[model samples]
Target: MRPEGIRLLPWLIGAVDLVMIALATVLAIRLRITLPIFSAAGDVLENTALASVFFLGTWLVLLVYSGAYEPHVFGAGTEEFKLVVNASFFTAALVATMAYLMQYPLSRGFFVLYFPLGVIALLVGRLLSRRVIQRLRSAGHFNEKVLLVGTPGYIGEIHTVLARESWLGYDVMGCLVPRDYAGLEVTSAGVPVLGLSEDVRAVVDEVSPDVVFFTAGAVSSSTQLRRLAWDLEDHAHVQIIVAPNVTDVSSERVRIRPVAGLPLMHLGRSRSQLATNDAKRAFDVIGSLTVLALTWPLLVVMMLWIKVHDGGPVLFRQTRVGRQGVEFTCLKLRSMAIDAEDRLTELEARDHVLFKSADDPRVTRPGRFIRRFSLDELPQLWNVVRGEMSLVGPRPPLPTEVEQYEDDMLRRLNVMPGMTGLWQVSGRSDLSWEDTVRLDLYYVDNWSMVQDLLILARTVTAVLGSRGAY
Candidate 1:
């Protein structure tokens, strides 16, 4: 959903909350036998219009101030409850404080009642709302049909994610794979297939998607990409969102503009990042030192185990290029026999398949256990601390891979390589070579801090699921 849609949800939620709070406040005042407006019924009608107004106004102000009425509350169970708890207490306290300062007098128990009432109303109402939305979307009554446009390599992955995520409210109408895509075949299921190479208007007429997502990674030339967008606007009465191909790069680090017929994209650390450059440096220094301090024990244990298990050093180091083509030693736990590298020649032609195999004869017993959950990557935190890598960015390529990079792919090396990045969360080794290059290029051109944080969040999900981990 768009951010605006999320904003709308809170308004509805806030309305429901206001009514509930007013009803509760009315009952609470009646229990105290001090009903101001209920006097019309000889304090027996149980009507408390006065307190109802007080709570309605108070809750409205509190909800707005606390950002309680936002779309995030729809999916936010505890988070929404936290905002409710805080807003409710603030309302009660504000009322009490105002009365005390004015010497109007009010009981403290009223304030105590606010907590349970607001929290319960907020949780139950939202839980029910969620069920309604889930049911509606699952049945396709409340969902959007989307036609994705991207290179053949990227379309399959996009389809896979959308097919699995039903709550996202998106139904895959079909995919438009770039006509120019020379490598990789499309995945089957979840959606129909369309031609990516055609003009946007033609595809729009055929698919009739409510929303159009144009993937930047599919096409390399900016001029052609812009023309495609213009054609889409001319052809369809649909909402269009441009998704640049970059995977790990954050938007905060990217800027875009039209220069003549070309779309020029600028990417780098911004002023905000400049301010935190020192902070990152400090984190690198402190976090690395802390890990080193605590892991010496593990290091000792692993060193001895590796000596007994595989008769090699526990630490595996490789020289990889870092920022500005600078070379640094990348560290990792040793997971293979010492001669595993020597066996590469025999597995050379099958390297791609070998890299993805769940079980491999080359992996030692301990190696298999550690690699399954990424314990083998723990030592790379040292490379990050050493300033040779970042928390998020394009993946570091091997020296041989770098030598084979095409002109367009060179943009990836402009920024520091990261220990974990968009590729890791998006499918890692399962991603085709073309898709990997496209994602890295997109990230390099569209770097931003928010994007980095999102990548980090997605990384957690990817890691826990062990999706494409090998």
Candidate 2:
């Protein structure tokens, strides 16, 4: 694949904004015509057509400013969505000012309603489009292929990285290590490195990768780095990426800046520390209560169905590890038999092959469906409402599970556990125990509110697809 393959990538974002802007226009117009309750007495010269064009321009500017279309960038995280929302408000305000100056002043109510509506629509549209794009990329369409080119150590590290980050969508065909380190064994899990670094150009010629990413030690000199770039130019389509030697420092803290005569990369920690205040707790409580209130009907129906089918208590509770390693009896709608754990020994004896059994007989008729779509987890909203959990965070592991954790695995307990999380959204039951650790660590390392929202949004699709569910 070539760089051109990713062209018009920006247009996909633009089209999403365009569609959302159109939707907002219709929503605004419908509100005006059909909802007398929302009708305003104030006069505004801003015509609907003009408003639409303004919104279109606003969305375009925001998408560009937000860097939503940056090549090879895809995450549902807060930074991405914050950009969408920030862009939306600025555009709305600009439009309102334009209206005022042109004697088309919009009512304050219209502006207030319009801004939220537009932002919501834009976010919803991006999320839906993200799901479709993720599906396509996961299925291996529209994803870039990379030929790992580095020293054996670097190659091995990168191979491990590529193997773990399946959502990033880079299919590592194989790796190319230095000739001195040739024939070295590594986890060729699925991707294998084809050749040595001595024949970098030959590797490029043979593999024709979309991007060539080199680690620091492989090309030790600045001259070698420049030469690699020049050699890649022969292909004219392959991109060159350089990974630095800096360790443990987050990307947020590491900023590359150009100083007098050198390219100086500065390091600074991210400013947004984990929010731990009464305000956030209050916000969580109110938000969860509102959601729980609205979804009570569905919850009642689900409870009834589970009770009728399983003939047991509707709610399940277990003392799981929580933030700061505190224990909390997390609540959930029971989606397994009362004696399901008792069968664990039997199931384990019957299968040393896989950790899960798709045909487990312990699940009741309705329990199976609840578990599949994760409806069984809905009762945890009470925990969310009670401040025992968050809307998004690391998953709370059972106390026994925590006891068995390796040093690295315990990193997952750094934050409050949530009803949904990166592990649940990424692959759920499909993930290997190792991959599960990797994802949990990944979220703990790079967590943000935006990342939480993105995880939550992706979770919806994952639940709908029932992929990797037991």
* Candidate 2 wrong stretches, greater than 4 Å: 1-5, 37-46, 74-82, 102-108, 163-167, 182-207, 230-236, 245-253, 257-275, 349-357
Among all candidates shown, the one with the greatest TM-score: 2
List pairs with backbone clashes in candidate 2. 45-104, 77-450, 78-450, 78-451, 174-192, 174-193, 175-192, 175-193
Writing each residue's lDDT as its tens digit, candidate 1 over 1-470 gives 23344336667676677667766665665554554532333432233344456666877788788977654355422445567668877877787787678765344444455446656666566555665665566665446668787765576666665665466577777677666653334445444566655556787777677777766465667676667777776544467766655544444556798898566777665232232366655755575577678877876676677778967888888888776677788888888878888876655353431244555567887787667666677788778776888777788777767777778877778777886787887777777776677677777766555456556656766777777765
By lDDT, the best candidate is 2
Per-residue lDDT over 1-470 for candidate 2, one digit per residue giving the tens place of the 0 to 100 score: 45454575568767877888778777776666556776554343255655666667766876787676676555333446667777777787777777788876455555666668888888898777766676666677667778766776666677676666555667777766665667754534444657776677888887678877786566657777678777777676787777776644445556778887567889764322363446546756776788788988988999999888858999988898887788988888887788988887766432212255778887778778888888888788888876778877767788777877888878777767777777788788777777677677766766565666677777888889898876
lDDT of 2 at 131: 69
TM-score of each: 0.54, 0.84
Report how far residue 187 has shifted in candidate 2, in Å. 8.5
How far residue 467's Cα lies from its native spot in candidate 2, in Å, is: 2.5
